[model samples]
Target: MEAAIAVLVAQFKAFAGADGSTDTLSKGEFQNLVTSQLPNLVKNSADPAVIEQLMSSLDQNDDGELTFLEFWQLVGRLANQHGGFSR
Candidate 1:
């Protein structure tokens, strides 16, 4: 769980910038960031079906990008679902 969170944080940092800040990512930037970073988890997802569903469900803002809160929420949700973490 920690590892997963760490990986996500690192990816967010990379997308946001060398300063490792989430505040720097714009809406579009966040979308691109997720598109590039979440390949492994999202690759086998459904068509316009799963991707669209996830984008709408997870993106939160509908800005076509994910904020830090959204990112963390998704991670926490997955962790819970997979028994990767408790509380």
Candidate 2:
């Protein structure tokens, strides 16, 4: 569990820092992260419009960027869906 969380943090940091911002992921960063790292988990990753809609849905603050928390929402949802967690 600890290792999994660490990997998640590291992955986020790796992408978040690509554009010199470790605090949030810009649209392009998010798209890259999803397409490269979550190819099997995220559907329609090849579609820019789908990625745009996903980013919009997860950008809770409407800041046009995704903070760690916002990004975590995607992680949590995917985990739930993959793990078949009831709730």
Candidate 3:
């Protein structure tokens, strides 16, 4: 569990730091992260508009960027879906 959490944080930091901001993920960075790291888990990995829509949904503050907390919402949802915990 600890390692999984650590990996999540590390992945978030790795992607978030692409634009020199480890605190938030820009649209481009988020797209890259999803298409590259989560291609199998995230649907429409090849569609730019889908990515944009996803980013919009995750951008809680409407700042065009996703904070770690916002990113975690995605991770949690994915985990739930992958684990068959979502109804």
- RMSD to native for every prediction? 4.9, 1.2, 0.9
- Model 3, residue 61: C-alpha shift (Å): 0.7
Worst 10 residues of 1 by lDDT: 18-27
lDDT of 2 by residue, 1-87 (tens): 999999999999999999998989999999999999999999999799989999999999899999999999999989998898945
lDDT by residue for model 3 over 25-78, one digit each (tens)? 999899999999999999997799998888888888899999999998898889
TM-score of each: 0.53, 0.94, 0.94
From the highest TM-score down, the ranking of the candidates is 2, 3, 1
Which residue runs of candidate 3 sit more than 4 Å off their true CA positions? none
* Error of model 2, residue 13, in angstroms: 0.6
lDDT of each: 0.63, 0.94, 0.91
Alpha carbon lDDT at 8, candidate 1: 76
How many clashes in each candidate?
A: 0, 0, 0
| Top-TM-score candidate index | 2
